[model samples]
Target: MIKEQGEGKSRYMPGLDGLRAISVLAVIAYHMNVSWAPGGLLGVAVFFTLSGYLITDQLVAQWQTAKRIDFAGFWMRRIRRLMPAMFVMLAVVGAWLLLFDPERLASLQGDFVSVSLYFNNWWLIFHQVSYFESFGPPSPLGHLWSIAIEEQFYLIWPILLTVLLRFTKQRGKLMMFILLGAAASTVAMAMIYVPGSDPSRVYYGTDTRAFALLIGAALAVAWPSRSLSAAISDKSRLVFDILGGAGLLAIVWLIWKTNEYDSLLYNGGLALFSVLTAVVTAVLAHPASRVAKAMGCRPLRWIGVRSYSLYLWHFPVIILMNPSGIADDVHAGRALVQIALSLLLAALSWTCIEEPIRRGFRSPFREKIQGWSPFQYRNKRAVSALALMLFLISGYSSLNADRPADPSPAIIDTSSNGQEGTTLPVTDPGIPAVVIPEAPIPMEPQPKSEESSKPATNAGITAIGDSVLLDAAPHLEKLLPGIMIDGKVGRQMYQALDVVDQLKAEGKLGDRIVIELGTNGAFSSKQLRELLSSLQDARKIVLINTRVPRKWQDTVNSTLEEVANEYANTEIMDWYSASKNKQTYFADDGVHLKREGAESYAFLLSKTLQGG
Candidate 1:
């Protein structure tokens, strides 16, 4: 979407603004967890390419015309344009967390500092935090990592371009250097990426992700569109048409084909998508291109022009609007409200902060008077009032929200005979109607002689599990007293073997053992079989199946049932069945338990143990 101009410079292209609209919308849809846009995070790659093209276009023009770059002016403009709105967002979020969600404040303290310093990606990587994994509640500012990457690019790229220009004026050599940088970045990403593990490190690394930006730069140097467009014939125009359409379709197809779980994405899929985006950009850059005209429609261009503000505001707005997070009731109405509010905030930020700052405010009163057309003024005031009312309503609703009273479950160590921490009664909805047994099941006494004895007492019960198990540990202990519970966050099935061995060595291994693994990741039939072998020494083993919204849920449940059937000492606790339609019992993830869900989970386990 390059504008046709002479004098060694490109003018503003409306179609490029439209492309920004598409990219920002994709990112917003992804963050909203829309089912259709599973690969919407690819929007970041689009932004990287666009940033590369625009910045290089400006720098190349300066190098060719002025024979030097205005480094101070360029850095100042970037800081003024991007930092003000970002600072406002961070400040608002910090206040919100302090006022409404104090628990998340400590975790986000580092986020604030890192994001402010433009190295948040490295901070997350150093902490070994996966972007996809939520250890607790997610930070609203998590998306700032991409901004950090762009800022880092801005920091180093202009000086590098100046050096390149000083060394040689040949665009061919410049293009080669950019290509080599892109290639090296791609190789670095592939080298560090491990299949089947979290790809956060590769995804967040600046050295790895710089390829997308470099690829865009390479495209600019290789195909300066004003020159290429004049050389094209009618037959070549047809080729451009096909290439443009094909490139767009390829992006949509890849978005549908790949998901966060796809291992190939880190290996080469991202690089492929970036290349495809560059191709589409090249097509749009041509002045005679019809695809550019089509995408340059007014509505898309409007969104594109204000995209930076929208991107900055949309994520926090979504997070704040969801009073209960993924657990809260979600409908089209709430979604509409979220979209409207995001747009309003973006429009306000553009008018109030970005535009005025960009103009340098020679005289605020005269500018405000000049800017105030009757209709525009009324519309701005009306939207501001609406936004204020909505914020107040949101604050009231959040303040009076009926959150579960029980704190998150404490981590328990398997090395000792540890009882669970204190648990309060679930306060969301009253306890569901549970058929409590006439009395707690009486423990049978153990036989001193070699003869067979009745099944071991409830005192000889031990439970091992992941975060879900941790959520229910206190309730499980309260329901089945004296039971030893060992649970931790993000525990996987293979880790269970080690836990079992540890329990056995400590002589705390129980006859009736509850295994609540497989919530974090999928395990194979072979792994299940091996785990079953480890538990064979127990009198009876209970396998708790999962209800997570992940792709592996059915495989995990079926594998557990199949293995439980093969072993007479094993039985399945069908948590998936019991938790169906009981959305109030769980958090947004549908895997971890809230207070109501934790209580229900404990009741289900207790009932299963008591022959319910």
Candidate 2:
């Protein structure tokens, strides 16, 4: 997330920062858990390309100057520019968690070291951490995966460039080599990506993502920022603007259109986005481009200048502020506050740490510090005190790496738990039922209540669902005696229709059916509608909403509510709402249940059934 343009042979390009501004904002939008920008995560690929171009341009300039790379000096320069702000952010985060959230602090142990060493991406990969899945108390350093990938590139690309330079003096040759490498990486991503499974592996892998960086490197070789001419004819300028504007528009479109799970993304979609980013970068770096002038406007440039620190601080701000880590609902006012705070902290980090360190640690206000007014003096003191606190936190966090976290007792089924349930009693109101072209299915007798309706006891209640149902199966069984359950892992709503059909065929489908299917992921109304249509003949149907950490949780719940409304025999169990803010009941991932959670969930379902 560091600034693209560094202090080297390259001059400052404000347009490039504007691009960073947009990219980082997109990343923030994705994390904001909003639906509109599902593809906002692609912004990181833009950053990858931008970094590749700038770093390669700088390295090429250095090689042209001395005919040899100064590895130590280059590495030191990178460390100076990037490390201070990161250390400050991590330290501050560590201290906050240490004092108020000891469990989170203890959980951060391995993450702290991996981030410091810039190996967080691989660490997450080795651990198989799911980036898109909801795990409560999410790692504040989770977003640092991209930062780790970029840092790895920054370290290795320079050495590789030096080696490539010795083989050929031609930029064409260099461009060809980088493009080939990018192709190989893209192929690897496609090969590794498993449809309908978590894509975190390919998403976090440097080998798979190298194409984005390589695309930028290739662009720099073909069109170095320094080599572009200041004087350009109007005709060429029009071409630059058209190509640049179109490329930028395409990027924004992708940000709006796609999401992380789209199968094509790993195959070629991401590679295409990177190539477009390089086009925009090329146009912005050109002196003749008006697109660059527009993007370099003051507000955009200002944000661009501090994009790195903004990136570093934003994720932690979002995570810590909403520690429950349920991102399904959009809280606009809260989001605004989070955005404002992130900007404020980013500005502070940029002013106090990044700019000062990179520019040789000289304070611009040294002379004024001696003759400051009361307000200014207080401000300086506050800043200094904050800096001291951050310094102390970093050191303290290091010493307490092995400190034990405070223990938390598991939540008892105090009041009980669960999401969605029991609709009004079904009567003579006619609703179109789904037709099954099969012989009459046999069903065992169901015991009736004194009111002449089927009882809610387990004997006649059939529960069909995914892993969440299995997690709570013991309690469901205990709460309702002889409840028939058919739950499997990784099941979705689309699969439910067939399961329902099979149950009906085998005379296993009960008049009272409780389904908890969407926990694995999302489902369309078409899928839910089809499932509900088949169950229209049932005496009662309970559609349990999910509490998954995935972005699709909202989709699953909303579709259930909407489709359930159309069926007279249906009711939605607001399980997600009941379980909200009750992470103590859940396991670490927040999707599956602990013993307490399962018991509570079962109790809630029992109440819904008795009442229905």
lDDT of all the models against the reference?
0.72, 0.76
For lDDT, the strongest prediction is 2
Candidate 2 per-residue lDDT over residues 1-612, each given as its tens digit: 233333357877878888989999999999888778989999899999999998888888888878887888888888988999999899888877777667657867989999999999999888766687533336778899998999999899998999999997887888899999999999999999865446788999999999999999999899988788869899999999999999999999999988776778988889988988999999999877999989888778778888899999888877666524434445797688678778867766776677667767565634221111122333765865664454345334532443325422221111001211112111111222212212212223333355346454567798887667877877776578668888655455666777888988988788889998776555556667777888888898998888876686776677788888889889988889999899777754557788888998999998898774
RMSD of 2: 10.4
1-612: candidate 1 lDDT, tens digit per residue: 333223247765666777788888888877777767768788889999988877787777767778888888778878887899889778777877677667556657899999999999999888766675442335678888999999999999999988988996788988999889998999999999754445678889999999999999888777664454536688878888799889888877666555665666777778878889999988877776778788778788767878898998887777666654431233466677788878877777777667667667653522442222222544776766677567546844753574546534322211111112233122122233212222112222334456345333467788888667877877876677667777665566756777788878988788888889877655656667887898888888889999875444665787788888999899999989988999788764456777999998999888877777
Off by over 4 Å in 1: 1-8, 95-107, 225-231, 325-330, 361-382, 395-452, 455-465, 469-488, 493-518, 521-545, 549-574, 583-612
lDDT, candidate 1, equals 0.72
Clashing pairs in 1: 1-284, 1-285, 585-597
Question: How much is the lDDT of residue 193 in candidate 1?
Answer: 75
- lDDT, residue 244, candidate 2: 93
